[model samples]
Target: MNQPSSEGAAAETQSGALFLMAMLALGTVAPTVFWGLPVIVGQIAQQWGFGAAELGIAVLGEVFGMAAGTLLMATVLARRPLRITLAATIALTAAANFATPFAHSLALFIAVRAVAGIGAGALSGIAMSCLSYTKAAERNIGWLVLLQVLWSMALLGYVLPVVGATAQATGTYVCIGVLALVFLPAIALFKRAEAFVSAEADNSARVDVRGVMLLLGCIFALYFGVGVLWTFLEQIGMRAGLSEARVATTLVYANLASLAACVVMPRLGHGNGLRRWAIINIGACVASAAALTLPQTPDRFAIAAIVFIVAWTGAATLIFATMPRVDTVGRYATLSPGVLSLGFGIGSAAGGELIELLDARAAVGLACVFCCVSLLCYVSLGRAREAEQDALARASQS
Candidate 1:
């Protein structure tokens, strides 16, 4: 990754609003696709009469592609020029998306979507690298979260009114293809006054490979919980005797309310305040998971689900923020997306298996356990970081 000069890092604080919007849009499209898979797959199933399991496999393929693509951009392509790199990636993704609907066989469709995922993941890698250059990382990332939710809402609105299931669906690939083309021109705006992470910087800060792995693992587990919770949401509602309409309506409002957490947390400062709130939010996720799975009326389920989203939104922003602070070299921050996306894929698959093996309640239990793992990992990361910083301070004084 290109490390910026001290001058460039200082300049990052004053980035224009237009640049922020462009970057946010760039980072969010991949997440929107990941989160919207259910609807996309559902539409494909309706159009092609594909069975459930086949579509699920296709979804995994795309997600795996995304993970691979992000890692490639962040590492091998890290030295590539920004504008040209983004243009190539965006074009590749759009081209793949346009080709998606033409696939007649299961294998071919997955292959096409996987190619698209690679491009999309490359876009995400570049976007995250750009965003890290800014000083207001959490706030900028908060806005990204806001955009992702809005896009997800739009996807749900677009997909549900028409038709859908999980990964293999994409009757709307053409729509996403069009979106990629629109973003293609915005690569110009991605350029910065201070170039992103320069490999030449001699800053003595050593890369904490162990800490980075821990954080990456935490991200994976957190998303795994997210997968389980999302998988069983409908079943959770059904058990509460709620209609799908009611569940959908509740989901909308819950995400809408979640917007506030994204707004409020960043403003609270990113030191002790961030640490304190992160712990609380993770705890809330654990509780929400339990509340959803445990026997409950419609009211209880609604409340738990709402809190679950709120915690997730807040926790997500802070979790990403941790990367730059942990690995100042910026090497690991770039790889975080690959791990994060991979986690979501694995988590979703695990949830599906748990549901079949036992029941929705069992899936919910898995979500709770995943959340616990993430929370514990987060705590360890915090303690290790503080110890390192303290030692650095002592050495500087001596």
Candidate 2:
């Protein structure tokens, strides 16, 4: 791979690594809070003397805060240099986590959670921006997706359980706080890369409305569709008459397969190859959707659906991994996640409401519709990229 040999590249790479590590650390915290909260909600309510309704409201406040933070970070990173913004965001997120346990009242708890969301969103945006400044810029999408998978797996596999076992939310918060501190060194490395900039900043790289719209569509359809499985995976297996062990195994297989695919997808191509991979993924989703609705049988339905989940995850990895490579990728790298998060939040909310009206099986159909929409977006992106290439080639020949 070609890389700048300037004193800056070395420093930037170090910073890039730190930024990624911080992202993994900070991202895990938010998800942990969300997932772990339900398991411990009763304990929390009893200790604080709050009812279930209040707890639900506190969770909502946190999510809203997080969404706002992401939007604000997207705009901020577009105008400012990255290192300063990155470090500040990390510090803010860490502080938010540390303070989460100290909220004595429901209102105070809700307020803190919202603040934490902003910090988390800001940290995520800066981390994506930092990736654009490194040697890995060309493969930025893959790296970001991989980091997300790793973070998600780590949190689900380890962190939440540890926190639950501790019976104290403080330990989990501190683990992430210490992690935020580790990111400071990475910021120093990023400064070195900025000092060696050779070309003027590309001005045409502002967020593209069409590109962002496509990404939003993908997020909404994919996340909302997949949510049916998320909200009812265990229930589905039980309803199908499978043992708990089988359900757990299926979930593990699904996640592990996706993680492997995300790591591999980015390495498969340098040009529009991601587009091809995306097409294959769409097929996988279709198959999975069909399998999900089939009559339960040990030999047919259960196994096929399990395979389908694994396939869908791999397909999702491809979609997410290709995101950072969009036309104005460098620009969107910072903002795309926020826009995408908005899609996810909207999708989740909408999907939940839709589920109230439709059964889980019907919800799978909704997911299929979402997947089809995402496929169209990918097709559009492919055409736009081809046009851009043709124009560049013509200019070069002249």
Candidate 3:
């Protein structure tokens, strides 16, 4: 048998590593706010004395701002210089995060987070576009997915744990701000968006209009559930008699669940097997949410949280993995984030109002419904894909 090289693997090579590292940096930071909401928002509420409704509204503003920024990049800035665009967004993200600790007023904080969201959203749009254009987009995307899980683990696990122990939420923002700046050095390695465009100009790259739209809708619905659950996850744990420390630690373990999903993601590929897994993910999500409806126990809470993160990872990966099956144009995949963010913002805002008017249980039930809606959309997308394949096959036979 041939022995593997000392370098470990092909993707671990210098040039690939450099490019992936740069892209990985952006990918990790892109969804930090969304993924770390439980920790960050929990800290903000503890320190700032903001009510659930107010914080939920603030989340809505920030995520919608991110949606706006991503949309702009996909359209107006499509032709812009890559390095310049990425550098500017990175700086803006850093500035916004650093400024967050100063937003004593609700309005001020909303504005600051919106700024940060816009910057991060644009960066994400560009990065995904770049990834889809890679020689091995699937492999690169798998690594990118894994990178997000690892970074989130650090954010929810180590960084926030130590820094958020005090009465200050400054550590959360400051650390992320610093990491945003860290991405600046990676800008030089970024090729222009145009450079990533595939040289093979084939009709197959064209998007299936109906199929892609279903995907966007599915992404939106899935993230809506995520937004509702994730926004109040820590708070929910508190309601369940879990301490903040325990809840935070549980999130770290939950990230491990997401990491496991990412590793298993590639082998699953896309089709019936993938859809079956998606159903299991949905079941776990609903089951986890239902736990909050029942009496809250520590072990139960831990189990639910782990399952929730698994569902989160699975829903997100399903979107990415399903993209090529539906469309290769690359444009739709970039837009999915904005759509999901919009749904997330709406869900967070709605969940907050529900929490204020009703209870966390009510909000969680609603979130479960959204997850089902997402599943239906997923089913529709799969059927659309089959229909397209059938049409192509018929045309070929003729």
Best by TM-score: 1
Q: Which stretches of candidate 1 lie over 4 Å from their true place?
A: 1-5, 9-14, 159-171, 190-196, 202-205, 393-398
* Shift of residue 49 alpha carbon in model 1, Å: 2.7
For lDDT, the strongest prediction is: 1
C-alpha lDDT score of every prediction, in listed order? 0.76, 0.59, 0.73
Report the poorest 10 consecutive residues by lDDT, candidate 2.
Answer: 1-10
Per-residue lDDT tens digits for candidate 1, residues 1-398, read 43333454324433677777787887887555786877777677877777989988888898988888888875777655667777788789889988887887989988998898888888887777667656678788778777887877777776544533332345367667777888877766644433334555425657777778778877888888987777668776876688998888888788889888888877774766777787788889988998887787878888999999899888888887777766666655666677777887888888889878887888888889999999999888888888988999999999
In model 3, which runs have C-alpha deviations exceeding 4 angstroms? 1-15, 42-53, 98-105, 132-139, 161-174, 192-204, 233-253, 270-276, 283-305
Model 3, span 205-243: residue lDDT tens = 465778877877888888888888887888888976889
Whole-structure CA lDDT of model 3: 0.73
Better of 1 and 2 by TM-score: 1
> Ten consecutive residues with minimal summed lDDT in candidate 3?
1-10
Models, CA RMSD each = 3.2, 4.4, 6.0
Q: For model 3, which pairs clash?
A: none
